[model samples]
Target: MTEGPDITFVLGTRPEIIKLAPVIRECEDRSLTRSIIHTGQHYDESLDLVFFDQLALPEPTHHLEVGSSTHGRQTGEMIIRIEEILRRERPDTLLVQGDTNSVLAGAIAASKLDIDLGHVEAGLRSDDRTMPEETNRVLTDHASDYLFAPTEQSRARLRSERIPDERIYVTGNTIVDAVEQNRTLAAQRSAVLAEYDLVPGRYCLLTAHRAETIDDEQRFGDLLTGVGRVASHLEREVVYPIHPRAAKSLEAFDLDVPDGIRIVEPQNYLDFLSLEDAASLVLTDSGGVQEEACILGVPSVTLRESTERPETIDVGANRLVGTDPAAIVEGADEMIDRDGEWTNPFGNGTAATQILDTITGAERREVSPK
Candidate 1:
């Protein structure tokens, strides 16, 4: 008997790895042949190691080493490398996630080559093309043959764009699955809390690394200063598991981590999840983290002007605090006082199984034409 064609999972940055790990495991358990292709857009070995080790994901089957470059150059190199891999593997389908250059590259290459494309974290939009991720997410949604939206808001965004409802499914979010599966592991095994001499629910977890937030000197300074001021005012430690880019930007801006603010290197995924679970509130510019915080039932202050996941805001799970330090401090205090009463709007954390079921069922129907 012949084996099935492999399903290729494309991932690059840290968020993609966290969000897609569960689906990879699902495919593995089903004995469906699969390949995880890393595009190297993140260009950080530690970033890759943290997710692989913490999530227990299989080492990637293919690494393109596309690395950091201009947006166009990075996306172009990924297109060429991924196209080459797809040609060689000739997989039944390519799975990409979220709104990143790597996702766009994989979708473009796969669609052009006539391979079925699956988009996890699909149907998300900020309606702001100035944010490259918004453009990436929109384009990938349209190009994909299967769209696994994490929420009804995500689904409606795709519908507003005239994408067929049949092509879309509300599959919740795999990050929630990762968070749920690992929260216990994190509580049991994590030393991250100890390393900081920290206690859960006593501090704010902060992470800001969006290019828009970091590229502008004033904007980035506002983030650091705002977070610093917020920490000072709350009389609470603001733990920043700093992204490499965010760290570099802070250095470039000569922004000092004012007294009482803890700036640390990126924590491994499990450790970070544990921290998120314990935090009094979350302050971040990451779209995925916003959703993760929601799933963990924590209030979040998004440090961006706009968010792709406004559903969190709609449900009172997150507030857009922009880059203003005063607003940041105010928002953080409001959330702290409010004490996160809102329920999680993301899901009950079964996203991976739903996503896999949707894609494989579609493939079966396409092949077996009823």
Candidate 2:
């Protein structure tokens, strides 16, 4: 099958949808044909459908309802369904973002079918194989023809792993573009601050749903307790827009929601970005949020032992604090009072254009490996 000029994106979770929206819009702006396939990995209406509506993106060309399931089942089904779409559409390139199972599946399906595959935000390594996301990203990099590393550090990691240099490009993270393009819209359109009756720079934001953090009751409890301690120490509220998975875990574990911490339902993309932009500090286990906090000049305390986005830490915008109450408290205290002096490492908000240009160039280069 000959490669076409068109492109297809495989995205499922909220981060994927948000990060890829800029590129999708770029495709539309250039009048280039593109297809979006939703793997349904994020089936919750809160996590999935509202993002497309909020971001003003086109409806997915295909939705493979591969909802919540064990890792094997979900990834396997996605591979099968994505393979079907690849066969039917036969697009030139299949692009996937982040470290989700959907990316891994798309990479596998496209690689097996001889379709040129691109992994956006590739070459990230937490170096912890226990984390499924680490595995997903690593495998996706090896299988991809174009590895869009978000930073030079990421490009170095790909070199260390022996990924051919020709395959790697240090195109700054698309999160920068998403944040730059949307913050004004969020500020103008979202009333999340008033809806919560919170004052800017007087409240903290919290989000923790990674399996390593929430799957164990002890760790999750400690994280909540620590966040609560910080909230009390600062006399500020810690607002958690609970992810559906974290909510279920709380119920299953019978964990108590500590004082000084208010739990809210999940928020849409714009609302959450609004909260992050105005917060005194952010505590999260999400890579996207870490990057967002950096871009928005908000200090973030990452609730994980390791992170793939070390650029956040290097810039003095974030701290990698494991879920220990005392440590979390200390990390929050250190970050809350800091001046927003760090440079935004992601880019000048044109990653989508650079990525699309690179892909277009790759087509010519792929014709002759020169």
RMSD to the true structure for each prediction, in A, is: 2.4, 2.2
Q: Rate the local accuracy (lDDT) of all candidates.
A: 0.84, 0.91
Pairs that clash in candidate 1:
none
Q: Alpha-carbon error at 245 in model 1, in Å?
A: 1.5
Specify the highest-TM-score model's number. Answer: 2
Candidate 1 C-alpha lDDT tens digits along 72-107: 999999999999989988998899999999999999
Model 1 ranges with Cα > 4 A deviation? 1-5, 362-370
Error of 1 at 223 (Å): 1.4
Candidate 2 C-alpha lDDT tens digits along 1-370: 1232689999999999999999999888888889999999987978987899989999999988899999999999999999998998898889999999999999999988868898999989999999999999999998888888999999999999987888887889999999988999999999999999999999999999898888999999999999989989989999999988899999999999999999999999999999999999999999999999999999999999999999999999999999999999999989998787899888888889888988877433442231
TM-score of each predicted structure versus truth: 0.95, 0.97
lDDT of 2: 0.91
